[model samples]
Target: MIVFNEDGCIKCGACQGTCPTSTITVTPTYIQHCDMCGQDPKCAEVCPEGALKVEMFTVDENALDQPRLTFNSSLCTSCGKCEEVCPQETCVVVGKPNMEVEGFCVMCKKCVEICPVQVIGIPGIVEPKDCAIDLEGKGATYIVNCVGCGTCVEPCPVDAITLDKVGGTISIDENVCIKCGVCSQTCPWNAVFISEKYPVKREKDIIDFAFDSTSCIGCNTCVEACPGNFIKTIGSNLTIEVPDICAACGLCVKVCPTDSLDLVVKWGEAHPADAEGLGYDAEKCEFIGACANKCPTEAIRVVTKTGMACPSLVQTDEDPSFVNCIRCGACAAVCPEGALTVGSIEKMIDGKLVMRDRIEFNPSKCTKCGDCETACPYNMIHLTDDEKLPVKGFCTLCGQCIEACPEHALYDK
Candidate 1:
């Protein structure tokens, strides 16, 4: 049967939803266990944390077999109180306290009552011939820093990867995993690094990268602009090692003060590499319904957002102009991952509200202190020779200039 480590569970309902047998159930604050699915249990597969696990057990014939004691590590401080009170010295080891020692624990309740933090817990005693749970036999384990992308779940040949409904990360059932290394190679974040033990290796992509240190002033602009966090500045020297996870977004290239960094995308020449009007990146999108929820025209549709199982999509390119889209930047503004980039801005053009830049210019509050020009990471905002604010270059709508303006001149359109 599948049981939960109550302290570790976040009550996300990931396991309950994935259970094929519909045995698992979850409430706002409580979670109920389920009978194991016999085959690879789906409940264990989707658990983001390794709080839930499967254990094989047989009914103990002896009536005196004591109930297993569960430990709460969150409330434990290693006070050694349980160790001092527990009659069996083998039961309560200093750091690794094992409350359930077969034939050792006499159920004196001395450790339970003396625990200052109440970490030692004893559940109801099981009747004779009941399931004797062996808690130490939990078969699942999770790697550190799992991004909960659910990418590993699909590649597992044995279906050992867990799916996290909470959009956190995934856990792997070590017992079910064949160590084939498919999940390790498929993971974009390298959350599963067990591939090193096997022959599986990720193919290297052809990339053309260039950085001129002579022109670079070490202003730390590229580090701040890069969304992938591929660039790092140490004193005056910049370190760029983005072969594995670089999206090639060119935010670093645009924010470079001296035009020192240059990157060429070998796959596609386009900067965004998407359709003109409403650009969307499926790889970066988490299907959180932020764009579809905020889209005024209802142009974008996500299948997962509507509780559909398949055919997850945004919008088609049939209407590249996005005629229904008001270009209000509502979708782009609300998108958490910046997946949806609107091409047109909502502004008056020939008495028509065409898609235009979302940025607004207020000349009344303009002090022209040149702070906006300095604050613009993309170097888009600048003061003309006559000291007039001239926004000539491409604006990413990053809102850096708005924060930099002391007079509160700039505001979102």
Candidate 2:
């Protein structure tokens, strides 16, 4: 039998997991004595404090790789404190009740600190839990201290939000809320926000932004108006790097006097480093009009120039309008040529529909084939040898050039 120093043991459960024979048991408060493995016991070898040991025996220098965290079902009261604190989505500890620390675990150890019964433990490292995950870039739309102003009520496509006028509070019906973030976008008081959450490491999608630097009047309006401070004046030109942290509020887009900047926001996703940089182009479009036929709102129109395919909105007898686009991503989803991409995809999460409210264009994917130039009804776009397809002033910024390109390179951002 092996001896356990009760005074020195921290109950981290490292030894029990490291035991080669599975002869050791550990709990939050106590550890069962080991059988010593009849030699230099692995349990004693891994014990952080040398609390477990055989009489007059010295263990080997090398330690075996073991599970970083161990669970004691007997000690777990289903208190749900571990799931509340852990940042990883892979290791869910509440509903599933298993902290499988693989793939996504960054070893932040938030569960260790919040466990009420001290049931959660990290072996070998007895140090305090790390608070090092950078969470500024990840978040979801949340309403804080809503004043029931009703500013956000009219813009909501679905009646998922409500205002309690008497109580001066806003309540969102999670069952009905589409998570489109229109309420978060329309809130004037900045009460409804994409508030920060625990940092879960995810493969981020980049933001699509466009700035017409040639037409820029060197005005400082955008730099001063930006609330996120993402836009700055670089020499005589304006440069903006809107990454994941941007709130997608469109303040800078509204403030720019020259109409130089265009940003079609994909709320709650990361933006790319350069808006004009590379885009996802592995998929090509045959322009067979599937996206046009798939559009529920009749918003997409397919046209071909010299066998090159592009997408545009079906023209109505009335004014040019894309206000009907629900952003269902049906066009993008059905496109065999892979020409169209929606701002986001609709997902069901916690019984609520999380949908993309807009679509963004990417320019790096442009092939410079003059398809957009030929497709331009007003003939505003010109393909220069030294530059990408540059649009001239008095441009309508329509979807024509976007639809004309076979490569799907131009973005309306």
Candidate 3:
């Protein structure tokens, strides 16, 4: 059913969006067929589809016990040898932006010996971590600076911030707080702040948490600080979440003062193993650069050159020498479109235009290999397989591209 059905899947990513594990990587070519490896394959192990006879393969124990592809950044020549030999499309796509190794790796040691500089090694693991936190404690500490000036009231896009006279403090409606950071930026007192990271509920006992209203001085700090508007005040009393409406964003919990919110999860809930975090299948990913904004870990940052080089993202007939592409060959390998090219030239950085050693690219033949996106040194790429940046002079900063982006995958602010 879900086993890469060509006729069924329109490839809009509705199922992948709902997939808790982030297992299904949406690639440019295909949804990444789950070659069922064997009777009890990992693909079939989690398939919500039918019991079809997929594919399989066997490898020698010694082959798997081989050294890994270690990157010796200092010695790399930016040559395309290793990437050309890489069995996995995403294994070693060296673009201007950084690239992360995905799960499709069959452990083939081709990269080990193929690397001209011997950068590949089998450390047995990349920087593996079950979780990461970006919380910036908006707690009671910042509330002291509120001063009840109400300067943040107008900028409060959601009206989550409100100052109460009886309470002699500012109060925030947590439910309505959107965490847009507008009020924080506009606040003259610099009192309001909110947590950038929120904890994902893992254990069964924790349904949610709350804030201490009595402890709340009603400064409306949380209201201005809350990106979600989760907390609010009713007359003199503070309240959050009306029983049925909680998205579990976790913003209100981390930003609240006095620990007013106490998580009361639904009794006896079953948490799926796939819910642990996110898994990205490189081969399945299409390099749309959409996932860059959603990932809290900054893990899925695929830079794109489409918008800058050519607004349509399609290839053009521009001469490689004119554009100053680095021609690192990283863009060539992952290019599903094969539209990129390489030649020596000069370009701009920051604001000053300077002459430098780089390559040229042809926008016409690119099929979206999406590999070169992460293989370059000056990777000015974005999400959606859109890596590498265009010549600075060509960039307009119109933001029209970002606004038009369906995934909102943007490299520049």
Candidate 1, 390-411: lDDT as tens digits: 3222234444433433344333
lDDT values, one for every candidate:
0.40, 0.40, 0.36
Model 1's alpha-carbon lDDT is 0.40
Per-prediction TM-score to the true structure, in the order listed = 0.19, 0.24, 0.20
lDDT of 2 by residue, 21-93 (tens): 3334554335453222333444334434332333431122253332223343444444444334333222233
Candidate 3 ranges with C-alpha deviation above 4 Å: 1-206, 238-243, 262-373, 376-413
Give the higher-TM-score candidate: 1 or 2: 2
lDDT of 3 by residue, 233-264 (tens): 56545444322222222334444565555545
Error of 1 at 405 (Å): 63
The collision pairs in model 1 are 45-162, 46-163, 148-168, 148-169, 344-355, 344-356, 345-355, 345-356, 345-357, 346-356
Instruction: Please report the TM-score between candidate 2 and the true structure.
Output: 0.24
Candidate that scores best on TM-score: 2
The Cα RMSD of model 2 versus the native structure comes to 22.6
Candidate 3, residue 290: Cα displacement in angstroms equals 35
Which candidate would rank higher by lDDT, 2 or 3? 2
Q: Which stretches of candidate 1 lie over 4 Å from their true place?
A: 1-206, 236-245, 268-413
- Root-mean-square deviation of each candidate, in angstroms? 25.2, 22.6, 24.6
The weakest ten consecutive residues by lDDT in model 2 span: 197-206
